[model samples]
Target: MSTREEILFELGITPRWKLRDVAEIESSEETSSSEDLHKGAISSNASGDWSELKTTIESCDRCKLCESRKKVVVGVGDPAANWLFIGEGPGAEEDERGEPFVGRAGQLLDNMLLAMRLNRRENVYIANVVKCRPPGNRNPEPDEVDACSSFLDQQIDLIAPQVIVLLGKVAAHRVIGGDGTLASYRGVEHRYKNISTVVTYHPAYLLRNQLDKAKAWKDLCFAMDLMDKKIEQRK
Candidate 1:
């Protein structure tokens, strides 16, 4: 049996090739090597504070994306959530809707969350490394991530989640700040802002590579186990 088949067996989810074929996400990246940057001054905000962070993001002009964004997706779900899902940035649909992980990718994510018996509307908080959507949905520029790092840091500090599941390589790099490959980062528990962290394929990537859903499922299980251990340790 193939890895994908094995995972489907383990999860008890039926495999439908036609459905899988229909779910492939088209590449949203534009063919532009131009690094046209917006030269806006970045301002420092109060650390360990939520209001200040939200205000800064709403009015941020530190990166080029701020100029083109329809809305800055700070986050959604419970502020005091024990689980936080962090992604790279907003996509076209997310940008338009002013919410992260909306549309198909979001739907897949919702399914994933459902599979784990967790709901985004409940004890799960979702946010991205960069609040603003990059033009054409490209990877967030390093400077953009840097400018927004403070906000993400503040959010982590504020939420104080037991486990953070990073949703892509970009998120792994932004949170962990290392040169390690995503494969190397997976299955190992890392720390971000002193909170336990796990790395996984982004839902968008999983949409394109359905076989990896099993691995991503493993990562989610790892995160849940870690959170359970933490809760037990608190007793």
Candidate 2:
């Protein structure tokens, strides 16, 4: 009957999706944020003019958000990783740290990956849809996500992660298709260029909401399962 439960119902997924602990997420926010980030999104597979793509995003001005950006967070992960994770964009801490998921959020993300036995140096990759952090850590405007679309697509083609985990609303909307509300979506498999995608709350959200850790744990388990299955398939 809570917001998290409401989201699970909307997604029509049982088990992990129904984590009714709204208070945990409510408490988890450093200040509620979003991406054009992805499951620690990777750019290894991008196609169509890497040179042009780099030039394009490097000088992007399609959205007002571009003017205030510190750096365009393209992505960081093993180019050969078979799994991809995406979130929205950088936060103030991320902007300052210049590393994806480095602050409190990043530390939690590292824990999430640890739950799945994924090491940042291996087995996974990370990125945001829009590299720059929006002013005041606001939701990325659609126009901003659009400007960065080329890089995202290329990253997909380049990395070719068989399994992709969408970490937050911005990443969810980009990789799957939704308004990016955990209150309305999670626990279902969405598709991106024919790859399997799972949605979950952002690490920052988890940090604020300790009670939902178990539910988030379920998501972590599922992700590990999918990755394991994919790894087996390569055999």
Q: Pick the candidate with the highest TM-score.
A: 1
Which residue segments of model 1 deviate by more than 4 Å?
Answer: 1-49
Clash totals for all models, in order? 0, 32
Q: List TM-score per model, in order.
A: 0.79, 0.74
How well does model 2 score by local distance difference test?
0.67
Task: State the weakest 10-residue window (summed lDDT) of model 1.
Answer: 34-43
User: How much lDDT does candidate 1 score?
Assistant: 0.75
For model 1 the local lDDT of residue 148 reads: 92
Model 2 poorest 10 in a row by lDDT: 32-41
